[model samples]
Target chain A: MNIAVLGAGNIAWHLSKALIHAGHPVKQIWNRTSEKAVALALEIGADSISTLNQIDTDIDLIIIAVSDEAIESVAKDLQLLPHQLLVHTSGSTALDVLLTYTQKAGVIYPLQTFSKAVQVDFSQIPIGIEAFDEGSTQALFNLAKTLSTKTYYINSQQRLVLHAAAVFACNFTNHFYSIAQELIQQSGLDFNLIRPLIQETAAKVQQVLPQEAQTGPAKRNDQLTIQKHLDLLKTNPAWKLLYEQISQDIVKMYSKDTSSLK
Target chain B: MNIAVLGAGNIAWHLSKALIHAGHPVKQIWNRTSEKAVALALEIGADSISTLNQIDTDIDLIIIAVSDEAIESVAKDLQLLPHQLLVHTSGSTALDVLLTYTQKAGVIYPLQTFSKAVQVDFSQIPIGIEAFDEGSTQALFNLAKTLSTKTYYINSQQRLVLHAAAVFACNFTNHFYSIAQELIQQSGLDFNLIRPLIQETAAKVQQVLPQEAQTGPAKRNDQLTIQKHLDLLKTNPAWKLLYEQISQDIVKMYSKDTSSLK
Candidate 1:
């Protein structure tokens, strides 16, 4: 399958390589910054296109792996072929972002975070696909199947919901790490010590629900320990407030039936 | 090594088995509850002692895997003979918890969170060891090395710091999962959809630093996405407050400059 990737971001960088690895012919790549596009294209052995008009109409699929806000604008600019499939890898943006511009538009959202420096195993990554019609959806699903073992034909609304959930799980959780780092630094300890625990924390979720698996001062409703942690975070109002807020949230959610400060 | 486990909690249950699997003899087991002690002792093929006075002086090590508040009280009840090494599994409690009653006291803290139902591979888990003296410390280190491939000779101070950090990375991050679950539920999506992502999110930190591996709306400072998430979470005030607070914290910490949001 000949593919045209129209973004040079982390998602594009990884996706292009993944496509190549899966034995797909990446016909062309394009980015606002021609250097990045050219660099990625060179790595994937694909032709680099500086303009949307330069994309080959004969390509089997065109995947716009740009930012959420840029999807509509990029789709409006790209002169898509009559029968060629056009898909964007934005989780939040509806498939209609593509559908409103092209007859054969879809979403090919890789449901994993990507970093150019980090070589992720796409086999483990789940790709959420959506298309304007069942035929196009099947095509996107088939394309996704080649790249990843886990492929789901999720609708635009479901994709948005999943993306929002990703924000909470991925984005919010990383913020917790950042806050933990700050607190550890303030306590005069190396942040490296928490690495194992952090890794295990997520690993545990596979075997147990987060609510049932939850532990520590907050879950146990140990006010003394919570107060101790709160006092420790006194220097950073942001962190103190966050600690207070999350603790309350935890108490309200998990330990509601049990004894709690709230 | 003849090991005596002195608690019947989650940590003790896993640790004793790990020690036994590592080719050590679990000589005796004791707990506040005689039945629990007997049960655990029978499971591990060790002697069950109801009272501390019944403890055998033949064991090479007596491991106190009790609670922080109960450690000192339990230690006072136990009478250790000379040259018998003693250690507590409490992360926050100092090694000195055993110092009052015994001459040779140390700490052997497993940096992984344990639940009764889930069995952890001790080979991958990092154990933080602390002892009052050099000789005792070496003994604790050797014992920990037998149980786990990753053992750190961390002092009491470092253990406390690590414990606090674990609460942040493990406990607080679990709360983040709760938040994600809550938000996804509010969005009318199944929580299971986010479970795989939740597991993968924590798994990523093992390979990359939290800061470098950070992603999502907050990391990008995507105000539109943040506001949209806030809007989605508005029905749930507690979650809304959490989302706002964490998003703000992420922006303040990771954003290029702190000029705005000031």
Candidate 2:
């Protein structure tokens, strides 16, 4: 498909490069700041567009890769035709956000974090495709399949749920790591000591359920060790709250009387 | 050094095997339950003893890798000479526990989790060593260096802190995985979609600090998306409490007002 990309952000840089490498024509790139677009277009052999009106009308697809709050505005400003399929690469935004601009609306949300300098293995990242119509959906699946081995048909609600789940799995999990780093640092220990343990904790869940992969004082309900940890965190109110809440929940989950959980 | 193991649990199973593989002579194993001791001893080519008196007095080191509460009793039961070294593989227990029984006390606690079915690379696991005296500490350093590339002279207080840190890094982090798994499954989505994201989250921390690697609504303080996620967890009181506490902490840590955090 002949594609034009809007915004030169992290997602745009990685996704556009992946698409072009997968033998698609990513012919034009546009951004509010044209220098970013120009720089990226230069690297990928595509033309840079300062104005949305400069996007090729003959392009089969135009992707708005801007932030969620900017999606509707970018969609409104884009110059489109009746035939061009329009999509946004946002997990939270609905395809209907683009309906005001065109009837040919779709979503191709990659369920992974992207940073400009990081080299992403696109084949390992899962793509969640949703569209207002069947043709547009099929177009996204085809576009997505070129770069990834996994693609699923997910609606807007499920996409939102997945986004929330990602926040817990990726964002919240990293925060726990940050807490661990803080605790270790306060004790004058190198953060490097816990790195292998962090890696193995994640690796363990890949082979088994997270509940079954669980190990620790809370999992075993060792109140003695729990109290020792609590005493250590007595001065840090924030960490104390988190440790207590998380440990209590873990104990409740693993305890025989799990009647409240389900 | 000729070593005798006093327990046949997770730590004993992995550490003794690593010691044997490193060509250290692990001569005898004894546990309260003789069957467990026999099973582990057979696997590691060591003698299993039902009575502590049956242990080889010629052994240079004795490792008490039992439960933290049991460490005191086990130390009392072991028969050791003035020249022999005795250590407990517990992060929370102190060298003082052994001081009651022997003057040659030390600790060699591995800062990693072990399961019966999995094969752990001892070279990657960090060992935290503490001893009552210089001679015992030197013996532990030499013994630990044979199996692991990383070893630290961590005193009892520091070892306690490290143990709490590991709970956050490994056990609490896995519980976060469990929470993510629950959220995804509750939405009728497959948990597999987030595995790659979880792996990358951990992998990013290995290269950079966790604070620098943090990404998500809380990190950026995106209130709109945060509200949406909170709405989703409104029915789950346990999850709701955790979400609110953790997100609030992340926001406070990242927000411009540097009032609360150190």
Candidate 3:
């Protein structure tokens, strides 16, 4: 497969390399900042193009891995033939943006955070694939399979819901880590102390249901310890609110009958 | 050191097995329910007692692994001598709870969630230690050192704060997992799809600050995606509230200058 990448962000940087490693030639790399494009392209052995028009006509796939808001603008700038499939690597984005410029539009959201310095194992990462037509869907599944063993045919609405869930699973969970870090630091304890607990909490979910993996005062419905935690968070009123409210939700979850499960 | 465990709960069950595995002869196991005490004690090669009064005074250390609310009650029942030390494995309950019963009061709180079915590596777990006096402190440290290489001399107040912080890092984080699981399940997508993302979110914090590891629309101040998520979560008003407020806090965190840090 001949691929062209649009953007120099974390996803673009990593996905371009993974494509080349998987024996798919990344034919072109383009970014608003030509210097970044050139740097990434040189590292991945792809040609850096200053403009989308410079992309070769024979490129089979075009992957736009820019910010969610930038997806539409990047799609508008690109020109593709019927044989070329254009896809955005965003869970929150839909297929219509790319379909506006080309009949062949699709998405391959990696559903994982990326950093320029970190080399992630592509084979283990889950990819969500959606496309406008049967051919595009087949092409994307083929491309995604090269990078991952886990791929799902998620539609536009489902992908949006996945993004929302991803925030709770990743972004908001990291926020809890930050809150925990602050609480630990305020008491003159190292944040590293909670690392193993934090590691195991998430690891447990890999094997069990999050409901089954749940523990602590909230899960036990221990009101005394719950009150104690609320009292301790009095200085941080916002965190106290989260502690109280989330704890209440957990209590309700486990306390309720299983007949009402969603 | 000879040890006596005063409860047969999750922590008590695992800690007893871990103690026996560490070559400490658990002198006795007691619970309000003699059957449970007998069941656990038999598993770990220890005698089970119907009443805490039957605990051997020759035992060097007494461990009360009851619920936070029951810590005081269990401490009151235990029979000890001047040479015997008593400790409660609770993060929220102050050392004073045990002090009311004996001067050899201390705390050896294992800062991890445990299940009787799963065997955790005590060597890697962090144990928080606190005691009523210098001698008890040294003794508690000695005992904690045997269980883990990572033991901190935390005081009663710090232990409360640690418990509070732990609820954030572990309890609240797992609650987020439950919320995410529901969201994914509602969309007919498997919860397993988000496991890798959850694993990486926590694992990243082990090596870096949570602030540095933070990502998503909130970190980027991508208002469009944030609004989209909020709109999607309107069916679950509580989750919508969490998604909105937590994202706002995250936006403030990364946007603020260094001078305002806590």
Which candidate has the highest TM-score of all?
Answer: 3
Question: For candidate 1, what's the RMSD?
Answer: 3.4
> Which ten residues in a row are the worst by lDDT in model 1 chain B?
B253-262
Better of 1 and 2 by TM-score: 2
State model 2's lDDT: 0.88
TM-score of each: 0.90, 0.95, 0.97
Q: Give the per-residue lDDT of model 2 (tens digit) for A33-81.
A: 9999999899899999898888887899998998777888888887788
Distance from true position, residue A248, model 3, in Å? 1.2
- Candidate 2 is scored at a TM of 0.95
**Candidate 1: residue B36 lDDT (0-100):** 88
lDDT per residue for candidate 2 within B1-262, as digits (tens), equals 7899999999999999999999999999999999999999999999999998887868889899988878888888777887789889998887898999988889998999888877889999999999998988888999899989999989899999999999988888888888889888888889988999989889888888998888787876878788888888899888877888889999988884345454
Pitting candidate 1 against candidate 3, the one with the higher DockQ is: 3
Off by over 4 Å in 2: A257-262, B257-262
List the candidate numbers ranked by DockQ, top first. 3, 2, 1
Off by over 4 Å in 3: A258-262, B257-262
Scored by DockQ, the top model is: 3
Error of 1 at A93 (Å): 1.2
Better of 2 and 3 by lDDT: 2
Residue A48, model 2, lDDT = 97
